[model samples]
Target chain A: MSFQISSQPIDLAVLRNALAHPHAGACATFEGWVRNHNDGRPVLSLEYEAYAGLAEKEGARILAEACAKFDLVAALAVHRTGHLQLGDLAVWVGVTAAHRDGAFGACRYIIDEAKARLPVWKKEHYADGVSAWLNCAIRGGFSTAAGPPSGPPTG
Target chain B: MKTVRIQYFALLREQRGVGQETLATAAATAGELYAELRSRHGFTLPADRLRVAINGEFAPWDASLTDGVELVFIPPVAGG
Candidate 1:
């Protein structure tokens, strides 16, 4: 399992190849992109920041937890920091397993956990010439019972 | 009294007008330290809206303070 934070654009092909294994028959991947709008407001761009030390540690732990909770061969995730234009990839998760269920389950688990647990923040630059730091409020509270990201991530 | 290094991020960093600082403090735990700094810095966020980290690890608000520690007050995060 590997978790990394990159300031540059993520290379998806590299990540996909890294998860290749002879025993793995299934692969699942997720990509979070910067959308053109959010909360009914137009978004021109986004900036991401991270407390690298804790983020990497927590992110890796999330991947490890997903591997344990599901049968998997490998799990990897990358989160990008710095300025990102609309449609740019903000985060990516990939998993490989012997079966489709394990791969898909672990992939979802990793992204959800990483969003809630990692010490990273996102700032949205709106077309209205205002930029604000997004919080759990937009998502209607932290880590809902239905499976959204939670606070502190240690839980 | 103990001296600790503190780092801020996002809103806190912008509000504090600096990313990091070092200070000697009389507070005994992370919670007290945040209260103290909140007053001194006029930070707008409440204790309940934040989390604490000591030496690059997530720590409880009531975690005890120690000399020469690196501390961070994490705001609500939105990653993914």
Candidate 2:
């Protein structure tokens, strides 16, 4: 089990290969990308900043909690900090287990817990020459009971 | 008396106007020490929204404090 908080974008191929195993029947993966828009405004980019040491520690705790809750064989979570442009991979989570349910459940739980508990913030820059700092409490509006990364809004 | 090392991040750091501090107090619990620090620094943090971590593990506000422990106050952030 490995949990990392990094400034570089996550390499999906590397993560996929690392989680592949002979005994594992299922491998579940989650990728978070920087979107171009939020609330109908064209977003230029986002700046992610973190309290590096504490964030990594909280991430490790979340990983441990998920592993205990689910029957996962292995789990890895990586989140990107610093400046991120649109279409860049912001986060990645991969879980492997003997069964599909465990892999899927652990993957979802890890992402949700990280968002709710981790200490990383994003500053959204819009095309209209406006930017705003969004914190965890306010961003909870974007999260649902199922989890975050809910996709774009409907017209 | 024990010394607790405090670290702040994100909005909390900006709001407190300081990143870190060390306090020597006779308070027995994390909450108690926080109360003393808040009073001394005059920082206005909402009790419910803030999360506290002791020695890299999340702890409740009322958790006990230990000598030379690191306490982090996280004010929440967006995670992708």
Candidate 3:
């Protein structure tokens, strides 16, 4: 029942311990890290910003949904905000359940749902003067370096 | 009358120039209230690309509004 959206870095050990319980026979964790390159350019850094209150609320909702839909015993999700360097952990999600299938399914659901629904946004800082908005296509099965969106421009 | 708490995030926050606000309106649906806010704030957002959460649950724009409900607007972004 832990949900947090903070500017501070996430503590993985704490998350792992929280998911360790007798009732849970399996635990699944997902960590999202900042990459060094995007769109064939060297990324300087990334700044993640979010409406903290809303983000937390959304995380809780997603957690609740997972619990309701799966046989999960416990769940924790945390997303980092503010400036982050390359290879920094951007998001962490851990789920524990009575069986392997439930743990894996719930963990995947949480990560995909968070990316699709969370209010957090990333600003990619590159070596060149150019920067672009990051469109999180979790289910779109495409790479981030696919160039600028070929569709009509968005406001 | 109902008062809805509205929260903006990321680029939308920058565009709106504020993070949160409470609107006291007689609007029946979230979509109506969003239209009012867009006109007042003079900000353009791709409503189809964005998602809305009412009281911590993902909801459609046509969802009915209630007093003291927290309305959150989320823009699409990447994460692992």
Candidate 4:
């Protein structure tokens, strides 16, 4: 699959193999991790959710765009859903191309676009036993902040 | 008249108190359906804050609502 979401832990090797090609001279990959903090608060964990069927369709479209825009042999991306602990892998994007430039550019392009466009939601649980769903009001300001959620506000 | 299968997520789900519901609506377009639901359910978010999808594909607000179609009101996605 070009792009997908998984509740089970991601297998990096599997995605890597999917991008493997004999002509590929360089590979670039991006991993988004569930960190322990956000906006100066200590985070306990995250609960990720998706409007599943649409998410898959949108995700595949993103990969298709990367293919059309960049000279790449293959590209794939997958996101995680459900409860996740600190430092858990939240998403992965892997791209393979004849050169490092295309691979790197496509990798960044996929992650950034996926973060902005996919129909996925994250609920953050704070260390103080507080929890809030992210993104409902995250467009709190008009800054072009590329994210793994740069200004995600919970609640 | 159309019967739409609506699915809610995140804050919308919490506000609606149910993940999915089937509704028979007189509204003709996706936007109209959302307006009716917003008023009836007191959904705090507006059509501008959410994206509408039908049958697993993103659709414009003015798109026609078909019977038994799966409708998803996607509140701002937070996927990384």
Candidate 5:
């Protein structure tokens, strides 16, 4: 798989090493971290879920698109699923290219496309002893038993 | 009628209390099939909120269905 959804904490070094190549003069990476706050609430943690079949396919497509659009030599992305604590890495992206501009643009393109297209959801656990699915209610999407999601996707 | 595998994810799975199911349907298109599942499962999310995938490829909701295809109804994604 060109992309992965893991239940373990991501190691940046491994992702970096995968892009190692003599032809790659530049590489760019992005890391999404879980923060402690959201829309006036203190977040304790988060639970992430995915439609695996589609997520894998779509993620691979995003990587391929970035490679083609930016003339990249390689690209990789990994997202974490399941409970994540504050400050934990939620997603990681890496792009390698012969030039700096291609690496930068492809890195941004992959992350943005993945955010818009992957079949993943996030549930926010708040300090108020409440947890709700974040942004799942937008545009008539899923309605939580707790009612509407208090915050749109911050990630 | 055609037989297909239906997979639910995110909010739909929680509402339906199921992640996957196999069913025989007389519905000719993905939209019709989704409408049926929505009624049967009482899915809270409406059709406009989802994207349909058949046999692992994203397709229009009106796309025709075939027997033994795998269908997934995607909820709004919040991935980073």
Candidate 6:
């Protein structure tokens, strides 16, 4: 499978090795890390949860689409689940192509589509002791930007 | 009645207090099943805010439910 859900810390070198291709001349990668702050709140940590079965299916579909659209030699994406501390790598996307354009374009497509379509959720534990699930806001309640949630406030 | 395995994730799991369950239900469509469970479990998010998946693929909320199928109610995804 081109896409996978990893519960452990992702090994970047291994992922890069998988994308190596004899005919490819360019490699593009994107790594999403657990940031320390969001919407001004000091995020202490993040928890990612996924419906593993469906997530893998959808994630693979996304990679396939990226390959077709960008004419990539290979594309691979891995998303990390469970608790992650600040600065930890949360998601990684790598693509190889004969030229830079395809590699870059496909890499961008995979990460963007994965974020918008993958069957995953993120919960942010703030420094102030409040924790809330991100991106569960009702329509028209919150902007399209991944901002603060509108759900019942909890600590 | 059909027996379906319904799985919950993230917020729905937290509200339902379980990851999944196999249940017999009279609801014919995915939407109907969600309505019944939402009331039973006091789900905060409504049908409009969620998407339903059947047998590991994203299915329309109004799609018919089949016996022995797996159903999931997906919340707004935040993956990166």
Candidate 3 residue lDDT tens string, A1-155? 86788788898888898778899999988888887776567887888887667678878989999999997999999988888887888888999999989999999999888876667788777788665557633234344433433321111
Q: lDDT tens string, model 2, B13-69?
A: 766788888878898987787677668765555455567888877789888888999
TM-score (C-alpha) between model 1 and the true structure: 0.91
Candidate 2 local lDDT, A1-155, one digit each (tens): 77888988688888888888888998888888888887677888988777777778778888888889987778888988888888888888889989989888998899888877678877788898977656433433342212343332110
lDDT of each: 0.85, 0.76, 0.77, 0.85, 0.84, 0.86
Alpha-carbon deviation at A94 in model 1, angstroms = 0.3
Clashing pairs in 2: none
Q: Native-contact fraction for each model?
A: 0.73, 0.63, 0.49, 0.86, 0.78, 0.81
lDDT of 5 by residue, B19-61 (tens): 9999999999999999999898887777877798999878999
- Report the backbone clash tally of model 1: 0
Error of 3 at B54 (Å): 5.7
**Could you give candidate 5's per-residue lDDT for residues A80-139 as a string of tens digits?**
998888888899999899999999999999888888888888888889998866655534
Which prediction has the highest DockQ against the true structure? Answer: 4
DockQ, model 2, C-alpha based: 0.42
Which of candidates 2 and 5 is the stronger one according to lDDT? Answer: 5
DockQ (model 4, Cα): 0.62
lDDT of the structure predicted as candidate 4: 0.85
Candidate 4 per-residue lDDT, tens place, B51-74, comes to 898888889999998889988998
Docking class of 6: medium
User: Against the hidden true structure, what lDDT does model 6 obtain?
Assistant: 0.86
TM-scores, one per candidate: 0.91, 0.76, 0.72, 0.91, 0.88, 0.92
lDDT of 3: 0.77
A3-98 per-residue lDDT for model 4 (tens digits): 888889999887887878899999999988888888899999999998777788889999989988888888888899999998889999999889
In candidate 3, the residue pairs with backbone N, CA or C atoms under 3 Å apart (3 or more residues apart, or in different chains) clash, namely A136-B78
What is the alpha-carbon interface RMSD for each candidate? 5.9, 5.5, 8.2, 4.6, 3.0, 5.8
lDDT of 3 by residue, B6-71 (tens): 888766677789888887988788778777777887655646566888886678999999899998
Report the Cα lDDT for residue B54, model 6. Answer: 93
Tens digits of per-residue lDDT for model 6, A1-155: 37999999999999888888899999999989888887778889999999888889999999989888988899888898999988888998999999999998998888878887889899999999998788764455543434434331111
